[model samples]
Target: MKPGQQDNMREDIYQEIQKQKAMSREKEAVGKLAGRIMHDFNNVIGAIEGYAALISSETADPVVREDAEQIRAICAKASRLTKELRNIAAPWEPESESRSSETTAVLSDKKVSCKILLVEDEDSLRKASTRILSKVGYQVFEAENAEQAFEIFKKENPDILFTDIVMPGKSGTELARELKDSKPRLKVLFTSGYVNEKGKIEEINSNTGLFIHKPYDYEALMKMIGGLCAEAQA
Candidate 1:
């Protein structure tokens, strides 16, 4: 090869190595942070859960029992947050517990009247998620896959759409482009248990907001939705 060509190839290899190193370093840092958080949360959650269980076993007083129940509820919320963060901190690993005790902390005191389009291939996950979201006051429209999601998007014109990244047919990213073409301001949230080489959602447009990873807790999910929708409205 010519001297110029050889130099160019060398530079390319060096750049690639640097990029890989950076990615590795970032992953290590994230993993460390996740471990620390999980450790701390486990201690807190265990104590609270244990105490709640004890209180429930012994207490006959309604007020005290109610307080213990409240403690248990708070602990549950913390546990969900910990799990979701752990998921974000490590994309490759899977969480066994399918259920997430996540809640949408609606920003506004007034009614949160926003339409939601949910596109997911997994039947049980879809149904469970739809139920959870609907119960939380989000008017959710369901789609088994991205194709159906698109049809529903046009028909429904939902404020925010949530979809799975990995699908048998059209991927969520492709569907996102189509949806944005028609509804330019439409908000999107992409979730995936399996991420690509880029981590979670591939072909991410920087202009687009957050891409929520799969196994996200209700709190994290709602926070994203609230922030994105709120930004759109603003």
Candidate 2:
């Protein structure tokens, strides 16, 4: 191999390696973004499913029930699609409940009246989830970030804290920990889009069932709320 020819080949190889590295970085960035997006998507789905469930429960008309059922079916399909997208971006272990398409019936004929402090950095999702939660008979307080959530938590002293795990500042887990120290009985529902390396949702304490994945259905949310509230009040 001539010196000049060998030098040129080496340069070509270096450039190719750099190019591959750039592509890999880009993929990683996109995957993280997709995971975040999937989380927000779940919030939207939760709102949609919640509203539909409210309608289904309120209306006596068969046609209205049918319409609500159709809406739920579409939301269920969307939830599945987002799951696939999130998996492509960052594959993680899913809970058995997360895989199921079946929606549970409302826990009781009467809506459980409770106060919720909803903390989410995503504005669209924050508004959507709050609206649906309020529509379904819960008093909901909104916060844009952990700081705001802290302020709201101080003032409202809500029964439950429904917060996104990843937030702008002082993550949901941090907020939950601080608040729980002050109010040990405060029921918390921690939600997240991305899973840790271990393929498990991070639990703040022994309350294993307190964690909920994104794009959750209305029934599941309600069930969680009811159970948490009951525990808190107990």
Candidate 3:
């Protein structure tokens, strides 16, 4: 074979290998993302199941019970399919958000950084989050769960409430609604391991402005908190 022809053939072979590698990498990324999404969905399903069981036994009102049961059924189906359809199938991951930018922006010009009430059931996370906020020049109040957070919120009336959605007694979503009901202008920043399942946050109006997902780095969390808290103030 001519030398030029040999070079062309080698180039063709290299290009084919690169294409296969790209496909393989994409497949791997999708697989990991699907697994993470399913795990979060299961957490939401568990919460719904527990809530339904309580409503079934405790509530005398048939209307409330019916609504609870419907929620339970929908979440159960979502859980089942999230596990079964491992790939990007029709029954799975229809609601996943596109990959958002990693950058987190600060809110408008403000001198005294907003006071933050950090509510998380996990102790390690609570402490770590507190230090992060403090480093960012905010006064931080720490609470282990939603109930404690409520007490703090009442006393401190901190500029912003930072809470975890999946907590023991009172979830973050419920807390946000409760606060907003009492004080229409309450500022809340809710974080979650389960953002997609049940649309727990879709109902959030302007009062509850920001959401941070699990495993978010320090910079991103602060930027989100700063921006939302600034907006709430404005």
Candidate 4:
């Protein structure tokens, strides 16, 4: 090859590499922003689902109940959109056959006395979850973040640590690890809209820790907690 031609080819390859790196950085930034937005949006949806449940249960009026149900249906649709957003942010591989089957299995209604330490930064969602769990006869303690959660954990020594994955100071996984170090028997259930930290969810699942995605309804929440409580008993 001619010297000029070779030089031009080298420059072209370098430019292509730089361009690829720039695109990668841009994608990473977008993913981070999307993660934050998904978390906030899911929190809103969760709050809506909670309030809708409250309205449906408390109101005797059939029309009001129907309206509440409609709201819940809307929330479900929104939840699916958020799930898509999560995929765009971080394309998660499909769960394995065994895990998929386990998730699909019908959870039994066996009652077991259990205490849950619910930790989430979002206030409305946390309050709604607390109300829903408490209404279902499970004792629930609430905290806004992991630091407060640890304090409650020390005091309550609850059966289940139901917490969000992302938070301001300490992430839920860190809290779970710290608490579990002290009390290995404490069952940990992690919830999140989108996992910002890669493989953390898989790590938790691998360790037999429980997880429920955000914007989950009362029934889903109850089933997860119930399963955890049953596991604790077993």
Best by TM-score: 4
TM-score of every candidate: 0.55, 0.74, 0.53, 0.89
Candidates in descending lDDT order: 4, 2, 1, 3
Candidate 2 shows a clash count of 1
132-171: candidate 2 lDDT, tens digit per residue: 6676578899997889888888899998999887777787
lDDT of 3 at 28: 65
The number of clashing residue pairs in each candidate reads 1, 1, 0, 0
Clashing pairs in 3: none
Supply the global lDDT for candidate 3: 0.62
lDDT of each: 0.66, 0.73, 0.62, 0.79
At residue 161, give the lDDT of candidate 4. Answer: 91
Lowest summed lDDT window (length 10), candidate 2: 96-105
Q: Candidate 3 on 53-141: residue-level lDDT in tens?
A: 44544567888877766765665466446545533422322232222222112211234567888887766556656654664478899
lDDT of 1 at 6: 98
Name the regions of candidate 1 deviating beyond 4 angstroms: 1-110, 199-202
Extract clashing residue pairs from model 4.
none
On lDDT, the candidate that comes out on top is 4
Which model, 3 or 4, shows the larger TM-score?
4
Instruction: Give the runs in model 2 whose Cα sits over 4 Å from its true position.
Output: 1-17, 93-96, 99-104, 107-115, 121-140, 193-209
